[model samples]
Target: MRLRSLEGRLTLLLALAALTGALVYIGVTEWPLPQAFAWMQEAMGRHASVFQPSRVDIFVICALVLLPLCWWLGHIVMDPVKRLLRALESAVASYRDGDFSISIALNRRDELGDLIHMHNELGQTLREQRQNLAQRELLLDTVVQNTPVALVLTDAGDRVAYANIAARHLFNEGRTLNGLHFATLIADAPEALRKAIEGTEDALFSVEMDGSEETFHLSQRAFRLQGRPHRLQLFRRMTRELSRQEVAAWKRVIRVVSHELNNSLAPISSLAHSGAELARRGDVQRLPGVFATIGERARHLHGFIDGYARFAKLPAPRIAAIEWKPFLDALALHCRFQLQGNAPSQPGWFDPVQIEQVLINLIKNAHESGSAPEGVTLGLNVVGHELRIEVADRGPGMSEAVLAQALLPFYSTKRSGTGLGLALAREISEAHGGRIALANREDGGLRVTLVLPQSATAS
Candidate 1:
């Protein structure tokens, strides 16, 4: 559009017309006739006996008249057009180069003039709007960069497209976060957030971040940024708060330990005093019964301490491959519950000892759910890159309250239940790159599934 101008086309047409007129005049003079004779002959279809001016004189006369006529007409028309086009071209070039300083002085009171005026006004309006937008964005960026809280903007693809300075420091250790996966930015993406990412629904999420060995509490919300769906995560330092919570937890443990120890020791002390008094007075007949009571109390206390020790001293798993058929056969031979499900063709990777402990806990829980050996079913299947084992039983399912807190340490509903089984199972599952889920079956009973990644089973 900038290369071809209306002024050039009009100028070319006018020059062609002038040249054609001159050529026609020369043809007339060289045809052995003047202009009057040519006109007469054309009208009558015969030569007329009329005296006319010489051809040279006629040529000179036509040249003078036609030259000035063509010049004046072109001056009146193309001069203004050429000026307007020159200004338009220059302004447009500057605009294309991003130099919006365009002031076109097209001094004409015509339609063409109106077009240029409108274009100039539009340019000015656009420039002003851009300036306003820039200032707003500048203020916004300043606020985001200087705030203590971190802000991350993930694009529709769920990659980190934008991160403020605080977010960079908190999530990526002060490194740039562009193009990083959203999951990698935060070590722990909470369960609700995981579901939200799967398109279930938007949810508020709170997760822990152990950044630089200082704990941080991250609060996340789903929101849109610049007309695209994004996630906003805010982080706050929680080192002091976490330290306080840790102290509180230790205090609670001590209190519970003291209570249990006092309960066992109080009766044991009484029994010992009775036995000593019996010894002094030679009451031999009651010695066995009192000593038996003392032995039973001592065993219970030892078991209690052992349970705490087992939970506290869990070792890291040494993952190794195991033959599935042999493993399943051995588990069936040792366990009371009925085994079911298809035998896995591929080997599974996990600590056979640690995983067996987890399986024992699951089987025991299923049996205790009021199910017979035949009523409990142990299932094994491979799902994607993971091995899934499920223990199900036809018994009364757990209540909602019990189901929620059942995974915590020392939380139990049974009279003699130590409550470390499920907690230890959960810890072991996580160590094997797996997880345990407890849910109520649709028909009846509780179903617990252990999902372990197949990568752990790799040779």
Candidate 2:
């Protein structure tokens, strides 16, 4: 407004220069043509004067006039620059302290206006960034505090710094966790737990608490907080999961036992009453057959119960070195059906008794699958240092649902089965560092494969 800007100052200087040139032209023109011609003639030995203002005098007067104006204009321009610098300093200080609630109120339409707008934008951006950071921290804190997993945080000196709700309850009956040494909290802890805290390994182990035992799955990690190293310990309780599984297993066992006992007891009771009536009517001819039927059922019940006992009480295998061919031959000699398969020529390490028991069960399942003797096949081979013993049967294979639960204890497809044979086979195979899998062959049959680790069989 006061000719203190680029556009105003340029215009002012141009107008002043034009005004000075006009004044000099008028003054010189008014002086006299005759005087100017005389001066020229005198210089050539003749009297003539021609009038023109000398360039030096005009330039000197212009310099004197512009100097004071330039000095005044500099003050006008520099005053605004100094004020802008002060405003910038204040904004910078506010931003340094993480406060961005400021806006330059000036409305000048210049480069300074753009700078003020940029500062406002920067302030808004910084405020948004701070809000985002705070929200993320809040979310993370909520999750960590509310989680069921016990979390204990320790400083670089192994002193406990913080603990969540679960950790407080686990370590000293909900006492304060601050200022306590980490070692004191976990005094005489289990080896597995110690290893977990040291970042060496993870484990599931039990610790004595309140005169009873409690199981915990342990994990650990290291991190930096406020530029200092910290460690975190996580303990997840496993007692609830284990108790649930145990209760479910007991329910299954009771149901199966009740069903098998009922099957035998009902028929035996009916036969006893019928035999009594036959004797009273003097029709003793069927009495002996009734007694015989009762005996058979009782014996069947006994055998069924015995099978379950054997499966539950199977002992650990006593590994021994033996020839695979001779062992299979001995089993075949005593088997109900003909056995087939050329065993590997090498000697193997395993419990001969346990391996034989597993094979006997598989063979029995195969033989009972169908009426054809050729429906069953025995196969033995070494695949990638694994000893595979597979028994395939040409009977109807299991459906998806049935196969899923086939390995469960007391679960069976056959109506008369006790469901112990395959379970016992699985227990023995696993004891020898082996596992069994069941699959339906494409050609319409079920194939059970036993895969034993090389270390369990190789000699």
RMSD of each: 12.6, 10.0
Per-residue lDDT of model 2, residues 320-430, tens digit only: 777876887788875554445667777666788888888788878887887366777778777776788888888888899988888877778888776677887788888
CA lDDT of each prediction against the hidden true structure? 0.78, 0.79
lDDT of 1 by residue, 280-346 (tens): 9999899999999999999999999998898899999998888887887777766776667566877
Question: What is the lDDT for 299 in model 1?
Answer: 97
Cα displacement (Å) at residue 213, model 2: 3.9
Tell me the TM-score of each prediction against the true structure. 0.54, 0.56
Sequence-dependent TM-score of model 2: 0.56
Q: Which stretches of candidate 1 lie over 4 Å from their true place?
A: 1-149, 153-213, 217-236, 456-459
Off by over 4 Å in 2: 1-185, 190-205, 210-212, 216-236, 334-342, 370-375, 383-386, 442-444, 454-457
Model 1, TM vs. native: 0.54
